[model samples]
Target: MRKLLYLTGLFILYSMQSMAQANDYVQIQAGSYQLGDTASLANPKRTVYIESFWISKFELTNAEFEKFVQATSYKTLAERYHNAMVFEPGLAEFRWLQDSTAYWRFPNGVSRGGIEAKMDHPVTCISYKDVLAYCRWADCRLPSFDEWEVAARAGSEGYYFEGFSKENMSEYANVWHGRDHLKADYSDGYLYTSPVGKFKPSPWGLFDIFGNVFEFCTGKLHGDGDRYVAHARGGSWWCSKNSCSAFNTVYIGSVRPNASFSNLGFRVVKKAFTPGDKDF
Candidate 1:
């Protein structure tokens, strides 16, 4: 009888802890907003409506990914394949290179140290499949393109909310700002990924929505391909005004779902349950 009571008490404690974690999700109200960018021929700007959902205030970090990996003993696509794309500073115009040892733990490759102090840095080198696995483990899902843009907009319109200027770019985001791609000014005090929430939050209290790392979204078919490719948004430290210019929320970037890149990462979202909700 004593053992049964102790077990019941432990179960209750675990349930409460899970509930508290779930409560950390931010509630985003349902609404209609314009999606896509006019500049891109692939994704013309269009108005769309989205249902209410809950999303994490910040991007998934190395620490969060570590927990998922430890709990599930899951091997990311990069780990299974034994290679992932990384940004090589030596390459001037284009910096991306495939390094056999690059993965989430060692984003720069095996030559670099593990993410000990960079636990707060956004987890990169994650493919779409890997993101899906993490979302499943967390009981969440990747937000659709429309849903992601809506949340990123934070109840505002235009390329950025307001007050976002070249002089103040470092205050809001992390992007390339040197004379060339090979050199990072580090005016933002970070050469690569910045710690999540290091910059000011959006109007809705979301962090690193514009820069730090490109966030993966749902898959979609583009061009003549029968297979759907995954999408990412917000750009990263590699983006610059003359180069990627990914800070513009209108931009919709796409890549193969199976490919993992150093500038890529993801966050999760959950359906918002309303009063009298009978199903999920």
Candidate 2:
């Protein structure tokens, strides 16, 4: 019994070490790829150059963010400000309201279960500033607009990635089923955020690049003065074709740095590094 337990402990430790070494990221090689579609801010489908960078395979999850909070005693903007945007269900149309108690742990407030039930789901209700703080603690940074779109598109050029069909959109992403409905369609078996990697991933093995939650990227908003907005890309579960169609890989949702929403989250990236790097 002792030997078995000891072996299990060693295996767990080894797995953790391996993940750390890999940074749990997918490397997009330096190259040119088509960027944007007609319905997007970055339109024209122009070819753009992207230097190689490492992006996390999955969105940041509650479990991972909890570790940073526990270690650094961090308080997210939602917690500090006592309010965050939440999608109130069972309405004539989508109702996004600011709820005071909706923090990362209780995404929809106390009505929904705690973070324990959502450890694997992407962490939401986090602001751009909160994301930056987490990245700093993790020794990583946010991916730029081009880098994120590159990884999201992989090698495909159309709105959705290759192998996408409207007949079975659920197989590809967690997007809304159809036209605007009071609540999210549960026909896809999830009314809210699905677990990361629950659906298909991009060709680069990056998961949940389409739907789940909008992943924020640094970008400029037109006519917005000097304040830049975080470009919320890839849409979210709340996105519907007739509504917020940013899920199509072209349109981008933008938010301020201090804004927090229930359907907005982010991933991290790091400069290309080898296993022999001192930091690694």
Candidate 2, residues 20-103, lDDT tens digits: the string is 756678988998888887655545567898888889889999988998999899999999997798875665665677888899
TM-score of each: 0.87, 0.87
lDDT of 1 by residue, 22-127 (tens): 5656778877887666776766778888888888788899998999999899998998996688885657675578888989998878786668899999999889
Q: Candidate 1, TM-score vs. the true structure? A: 0.87
User: How far out, in Å, is residue 42 in model 2?
Assistant: 4.2
Model 1, global lDDT: 0.80
Candidate 2 runs further than 4 Å off: 1-20, 38-42, 92-94, 275-280
